[model samples]
Target: MKYTPVQYKVNATILIKSEKSGMLSELSAFEDLSIVKNNNKEVENEIEILKSRPLFKNVVKKLNLNYQYFAKTKFSKRLVELYDNTPIKIIFKEDSLIVDPFANFIISIHSKNDFTITEEGYDSIKNGVFGQVISTRIGSLIINPNPDYLDSFIENEIFLSIKPVMDIVEDYKSRVSIGLVHQDANVISLSLNTTVKAKAKDILNGLVEEYNIDAANDKNQIYENTASFIKERLSIINTELSDIEQGVEVFKTSHNLTNVTSETELFLERSSENKKGVLETNTQLGLVDFMNEYLKENKESLLPVNLGFSEESIIRIIAQYNETALRRDEVLKSTTLKNPIVIRLNEKLQSLKLSLKQSLDNQKKTLKIKLKDLQRQDSVMNAKIASLPKKERELRDIVRQQEIKETLYLYLLQKREETAISLAATVSSAKVIEKAYSSKNPIKPKKRIVLLAAFMAAFLIPIMILFFKDLLDVKIKDKKEIQKKLDIPIVAEIPNTNTKGNFIIAKDDRSIVAEAFRIFESNLKFLLSESNNQTKTILVTSSITGEGKSFISANLSIILADPDKKVALLGLDLRSPKILEYLNLESAKGITNYVSDKNLNLEDIIINLDNIPNLDIINSGIIPPNPIDILKSKRLQELFVKLKSQYDYIIIDTPPINLVADPLLLADYVDLCIYVVRLGYSDRELLSVPENLYKNKRFSNISILLNDVNINSKKYYGSPYGYGYSKPKSWWKF
Candidate 1:
C-alpha cells in the first residue's frame, strides 16, 4: 500500500483576527466607529467561507482540475499525477473543445517536441508536434513539453482524463478539512490531502486569496459610498466658497474702502471673536440638519460616515447604522427584503437610525443655544459700534462669510482625499499565520509499519485459528468432557497403548498401561465391596460403536483373572462378535449356540484360554439372524446366573447403547455397569445418553471409563481421575 501511492498533507493556517483595518478605506470608516473586536462567530463564518462551494469552484476552475494529467514513467507501474509541475502541458482551443465531455488518452513522448496521442479505447495513434494544434475527436489539443522536465519525460507516457467541473469540485470539497485552531482565538486551520503536493498547496493558497478578495470587497463597499458622498459635498462647498470670496471683493470695491480707523479696527477685532463662536455653532447645526435630512431621504441606504459631528455618540451610531444598512443590502442581493437575515438587519437599521436622529436632534438643540448666546453678544458689540460706517459693517460680514465657506470647503476636500486613498487601498482581510507547507513524508500507509503488521498477521492468523478451533471443539477430548457433561463418577482412565491387541494386561508387565489396569481393578474392588453377591458382573457399553467398550471389557477381565480368582470375559454381542478375532481363536459353539439350543448348558458356551490362568472367554459362535430376540430369551438370564456363581468376576461386552437396545436389555443383570467413552472420538452430545441412563436407574451402579486416554496431554497425569486433560487455549495466546 505504501509503495502504491504517496499522499502528502498540505496545510495553511490563518488567523481570522481581523481588526478595524489600518487600510485607508477602513481607517476612514473606523474614525466614526468604535473598534469592534473579532469574535468566534466571525472566525466560524470565515471557516465556512473557506469550505464554501463557490470559493472552491473558482479554485477548481482556475486550476482546471477537470482536465487532469498523469505521468507514467517506464519503470513505474502507477501513474503519477502531474499537477502544477506537470512534465507536459496541454492547451486546448476553447472554441474547438467539446463542453464537459469525458475523454481519456495517452501521449507517449519520444523527444521534447515529438509525441504520439493514443486514445485509450482506440488502436490508432495520432502524431503531433509541440507547437502545432492537432484536431481530435475530443478537442483541438496543443501538446507541449515543460522546459524543466523536457528531457526527463522523453520516454514517459502522459495520460489525460477530462471530467466535469462539478465532479472535480465535489471531489475537492470532500478532501478538504477546515477548523478553528482554538475555540476562542479566532484562528483557523485548513488542510487538504492529495497525491500531488504542488496541487494541494496551490488549492489552499487560491482558496485563501479568493476568501480575502471577498472580504476586501465587503469592506470596500461602505468606504466607496462614503467617498462618493464626500466628493459631492466638496463640489458644492467649493462653489459656495468661491462665490463668498467674490462677494467680499465686490463689497470692498463698491464701498471704496482702502483703510479702517483705529476705533473701527478695535470694534471689528472684538466682534470677530464673537463671530468665530457663531460660525462654529452654525456649522454644527448645518451638519446635523443635513444628516437628519439625508437619513429621512435614504432610509434604507448607507449613511455617509466621517461627517464632523460634535457628539461622539452620534458619530458612533451613524457608523453602526451604516454598517447594518450595508449588511442588509448585501443580504438582499442574494435573496429578498423578506429574508429573515435581511429583515433582522433592516429592523436593526431602523432602530439605529432612530437613535442617530435623536442624537442629531440633541446636538442641533445644543448648537442653537450656543449660537443664540453668541449672537446676543454680537448684537451688543454692534450697538456699541453703531456710530461706525454701515459699509464697513457690510464688508466685515462678507469677509466672515468667505472665511466660513473656505474653512468648510478645505475640510471636506481633505476628507475626500483620505476617503479616495482608502478606496484605492483595500487591505486584505485574511492574515496568513503560516503559508502552505506540505509535510516531508506521506500521511498514510507507512511502509515499515504496514510490512511489519502484515508479517505478524501471517504468523498469528493460523495460530489464532488453531486456538479457536480447540476453544470451540465439541469432541469429548478428555475425562473433563465426561465429568463436565455427566454427574456420574468416573471409575478409571485407560491409558492409550501402542499394543494393537484388545487385552494388554500381563501378570509380569510393569508398564504404565499395565499399572493403569491394576488401578482400575482396585477401584472396582472398593465399588463392589457392598454387593452381597459372591461374583460381580461388569457390563461395558457405549453410545457409539468405535468408543472402545470391547477393549475395556477384555483388558479388565484379563486384569481381574488373578491366580486365585475366576474371571469370565463374556461377549454378548451376537450379531457381530469381536472377541474371537481379538483373541485369535476359533469357536464352533458359544453363547449364541447355547441360547439357540434349549438343551445346551452354560459350560458348553464358555471357552477357556490355555495361555492364561483362570481367564475364560465366551465368544458368540453362530451368527443369529435376530440378535435382540436371542438376547431376550429365558436361556440368556439363566446363563448369566450360572456364570455369576461360577466366576468371581464377569465382564460382559454388549452392543453400543445408542446403536441398539441390546446393552440396555442387560442393564438389570449386571452388578456394575461401565460406560466406555473414547477420548477424542465420542461427541460431547453422546454423554447425555449415559447421564440419562444413570439418572433413570437403567443400570445398577453406573460408572464411566474414559478409554484410550492420551496420558501425555496437558496436565492429565495430575488430575483427580488421572485422565488426559485438554484445556482451551487462552484468547490472548496465538
Candidate 2:
C-alpha cells in the first residue's frame, strides 16, 4: 500500500473571552500566517471569487455573511521558541494502498539496533554473517490517535450496539426475569438441594415459553414491519428534501442572490486593481458573499466543524425580508382601498336619489291642484298686463314696482330660511340679572379715608334734614328756616339766661350769660348808631306760645343797663305773666294796671335789683283777656314816646312769629329786632317768617343768635367758640 502525505493547516483564530463586556477579545491572530491582512482587499477578493461560483454563491447569499477583519501580529521568534516549542501531529491508518508511514510500523523501537544481530546468535545468518543492519526507528513511541480517522470506527460500534437493542425493544420480544431463594437455615429449614431444584424448574419453564413465542412470531413478520417503517421514513425524507429546496430558493430570492454568480462575473470584468474598484465589487456582491468566501478558503479544514455564517449576515437577511414584506403590504393597501372622492360621490348620489323619489311622489299628489291654480293666476296676470299701454310711462312704472316687490319678497324668503337655521342652531337663551344698577359707587362716610367727615356731618345733617322735609311737605317750621330758604337774613338772636346768679330785673348787670346778651347789645348799638330815630320802647312778641318772650325781655333789659343807663323789662303778654317768675320778683301792679290806670308812673311800678345798678323790672299788673286792645290805646303810644331818653338799648321778646299778630303789629315801634333761633328745639320750617320779615324790610334792624348751643357737641372741636382744638398725632409710632 502507498500513501501520500497531505498536510492541512487550519488558521484558527481563537479569542479569549473578555470579562468586562462578555465578548471575544478584540485582538486575535491567525497562527498560520505572520502578516494579517486587516483590509477590505482580502475580504473583497474572497467575495469576488466566491460570487463567481454558482452553488457556493447561493449558499453565501442565503446565509447573508459579512467580511470583517481584526488586527493581527506575529509573535517574535524568541517568544515563539519559548512558548510554542512542542510539535503536534496526528497519524492514522487509511487503505493499505495509502498507508501512513508513522502508523504502518507494528512495533516502534526507541534505541538503535543492528538487524544482523539476532536474539540467539549471529552465526546462523544466511546471506552476510557478521554484518550489522541499521535500525529504522527515529523517535520515541507515543500513543496518539487522530479523531478524523477514528470517527467511522466509533460510529460503527455505536450503531451496532444500539441496533439490536432497538429492534428487540420495537418487536416487544425482550423480557426480564428475577429468581429468589431462602438460604438461611433458621428462617427456612429446607435443604439447599430442594431449593435449587424448585427455582431451576421455574426458570426453565419461563425461558422455554418466551423462546417458543419468539420462534412462532418468525422473521417474516419482523421483515414486514421493518419494510413498512422504512417506507414511511423514506417518504418523510423526500418531503423534507423538497421543503429544504423550496426554502433555499426562497432565501436566494429574498436576498437577491439568484443571479449572484453571473453578476459577480460581470463585476470582475469591469473591476480594476484600485481601491475604488475593489470597494465597488464588494458593495455589489454584499457582505454575505465576502465572509463566506473568507471562512471557506482561509479555514477550509475547520469549515465543516467550527465555521458558520456570522451574526451580521443573519441580521441582514432578516432586515431585507422585513423590508420586502412591508413594501408588498404597502402596494396591496394602495391597490385595494377605495378612493375618497368616489365614496363622497356615492353618498351624495344616494341622498339625491332619495330626494328625487320623494319629489316624484309629491308631483303625483299635487299635479292637478297646482296646474289649476297656475292656470287661473296666469290668466289673471295676462289680462292685467294686456290692458296696460305698451309705451306708457305709467305702465313702465307699474312694471318696475312689481319687479322690485317680487325681488324683495324672494330675498326676504331666503333670509327667513337663514334665520330659521340660525335659530335652530342656537343652544341657549340669555337673561338679564339686575339691569346693571346704575354702575356707581355710592358716596358714604369713611372716617379712615378722610379727616373731614365730622366737619361735613355738622353742616350736612341740618341741610339734609331740611331737604328731606321739603321732599315730604311744604309747611314752614321756623322764622329763621323760612328766612334762610327765602334767602333773607335773620332779624335777631336773643340770648337765653334764666339762672339765679345771672338773675336781674330790667337793670341788673351781674351775669356772665349777660355778656352773651352784649352780642344783642352790640347789634342794637350798630343799628341805633346808624339810625336817626331815638325811640326806646320796643314791643317783643312771637308767633306761638313759649317763645322765650319774658326771658329775652329781661336779659335784654339787664344787658342795656350798663354805666348808669336805665332799662326796664315789661311783661307784655297780659294773659300769661312769666316775667315775675323769671326775675324772682313779685309785683302787685304790672303793665296792665299801669296801662289801664291814669296816674301810674315809671318810679311807682318799677322794681330794682341790688346787683344791677341801673336796671328795673315791670311785671304785668294783672292777667287780662284783651291786652291787645289796651296796648292799642293812644296812651300806650304816648307812654312809649315818654321813655325815649331813659335807656340806651331796649329789647322786647314776643310771641312766636307764626302764632300771633302782635309782633307784626309792634314791628313799627321797635328800633331794632333780634330773632332767637334755639338749636334742636326750634322747628326749621318756621324760620321763613323772620326771613320774610327781613326781606320785606319790616324791621329797622334784625340779627339772629343760635341759642342753647352745647359747646361739648361733636360738631365743634372743643368749645362753641373754637378753643382747645388740637391736631392729630402721627400714625407710625402707634
The C-alpha TM-scores of every prediction are: 0.67, 0.32
Backbone clashes under 3 angstroms, per model: 2, 49
Tens digit of per-residue lDDT, candidate 2, span 1-734: 01211121111111111122111122222222111111111222222221222222232223211111111123321111101111112121222212112212211212122112111222332211112222322222222322333332221110000112223222212121212123221111101111122222322233333322332232123223323432443354346545555655565556454333443344324432322332332222222333244334532111111111223334333233222322233233324326663344345444533443344344433434544554465445445445444433233334333433343334334333333332233211111111111112212233344447667888999999989976876433334444456554444543334354534533333333454567666766665676676546555654455555666677667667777577766566566667778777766676677778879886677777788877766666787678678668776676566556665545555556676565666666787665665655666666666777778888876656555544334543332242233234478744
Q: The CA-based lDDT of model 1 is what?
A: 0.79
Residue 460's lDDT in candidate 2: 96
Write one digit per residue (lDDT tens) for candidate 1, span 477-532.
87766677789998888877756545556677666777788899999999899888
Please give the CA lDDT of all the candidate structures.
Answer: 0.79, 0.41
Candidate 1, which ten residues in sequence have the lowest lDDT sum? 32-41
Per-candidate Cα RMSD to the true structure, in Å, reads 8.2, 50.9
